[model samples]
Target: MHDAISYLLFLVGTFLAAGVVKGVTGMGLPTVAMGLLGTVMPPASAAAILVIPSFVTNVWQLFYGPSVAQLIRRFWPMMLGIILGTVGGAALLVRVDPVWSGCWLGVALMAYAGYALIAPAFSVPAALERRLSPLVGLITGVVTGATGVFVMPAVPYLGSLNMSREELVQALGLSFTTSTIALAAGLFAHGAFQVSQLGTSAMAIVPALIGMWAGQYVRMRISPKRFRQCFLFFLIALGLELASRPLL
Candidate 1:
């Protein structure tokens, strides 16, 4: 796997694909990278490859997105839940089997698909807003911490809120930031985190960021309806990948 040709092809293809997804969606670098690598590599290796890239891309969003303060204030309810949930998910990492962990990831992706298919509209009910917001965050955090892929329960709930584009960007940025930090810590605890992977992950960051930035430009050109269609399509694909992991 570490031979020159295989390594070169993996880096180039995965980097470009990850970047394209991020550029268009404002997130998904890790999802795309992990999905592509998961075809061949173990889940841990897939996750390890994206660590630096994920951290860098989220950092870019955290600093560059407009209206951070307003978004934080408005979204605090859900954010708090994410923090708590992430802690629980991270703890589960030590206790759970890797195969089961993979299955949990599949559940998250499938759940996201169901949500996207049935309730594409993001209008959260006022009652749900009061009760469900924190739970959504917790689920997002836990899934993120244990699985290294966070597509489900968290993103769908957040997507439902009536956030302006910039505010949405900020919320996602913060969520990913918390999750990444937790994931890094867990990997370190398991002796999976290494200085060598840092360099490789850093190298992968270039294409991932480029793809995301380019996607922003294209996103601006697309109308709202078209954008949503594309978003849902991507979510479906992500879901299938997760659901089929055992067979693969």
Candidate 2:
């Protein structure tokens, strides 16, 4: 963050771009925001600024297409694992170098982009869900805690669950919402999250929402697959940029 005005402009632009990605693809807000912001700021500061908007948006998405109770009943272990893993791994941010954090963050972004672009065909047996979900959640949470991006193995794991599209979407909402809460808690535990970040983080909501609205409109009229491919490719580029920072 440089001058106040420039910071706000950049914040708004970054989040607006993130919102559009999420609107079109049903995910990617944190991934895109963290990737871009991590380039210029430490992971902890970026994570702090990200907490509110990510929570607000994902919470909204969480309630829309399913029974929350059923989701919790089925996914509680995994959710619990996320909380535990995030709590356990949060110290990485306080202890590790920011350059290492950014490099890992970029790798996480690239991992997700490659997976989503390829859209691998795989499925978990229903019987195995009970055994595997928590493991996936824990890995996701550790990544979330370490890098401030939480999609990786979790999103791909979710897709592998063979859930119906509606359930899948809402489940992702729940997963993201849970990750956001845990990330906030992790930041709070270190006192890295502060009230000073709140105003700008909250102000970011308007642009994010506006961009989402616009993206929804674009989603209807265009080839979403094509748009998504472009977005994924862009993420790969961003990933490369961030990953190169330590070297640069």
> lDDT winner among the candidates?
2
Where is the poorest 10-residue window by lDDT in model 1? Answer: 86-95
The C-alpha lDDT values of all candidates are 0.70, 0.88
**What is the TM-score of each predicted model, taking all chains together?**
0.80, 0.97
Candidate 1 ranges beyond 4 A from true positions: 73-77, 91-100, 125-131, 217-242, 245-248
* Tens digit of per-residue lDDT, candidate 1, span 73-92: 76677777766665566555
C-alpha RMSD by candidate, in order: 3.2, 1.3
Clashes of each: 6, 0
Worst 10 residues of 2 by lDDT: 87-96
Model 2 stretches with alpha carbons more than 4 Å out: none
lDDT of 2 by residue, 1-248 (tens): 36977877889999999999888988999988898889789988999889888988898888987578898899999999898888767789757899988898888889889988888799899999999989989998898898899897889888888788888888999999999999989988977788898887788788888877878888999999999999999999989988888898
- How many pairs of residues in model 1 come into backbone collision? 6
Instruction: Give the TM-score (vs. native) of candidate 1.
Output: 0.80
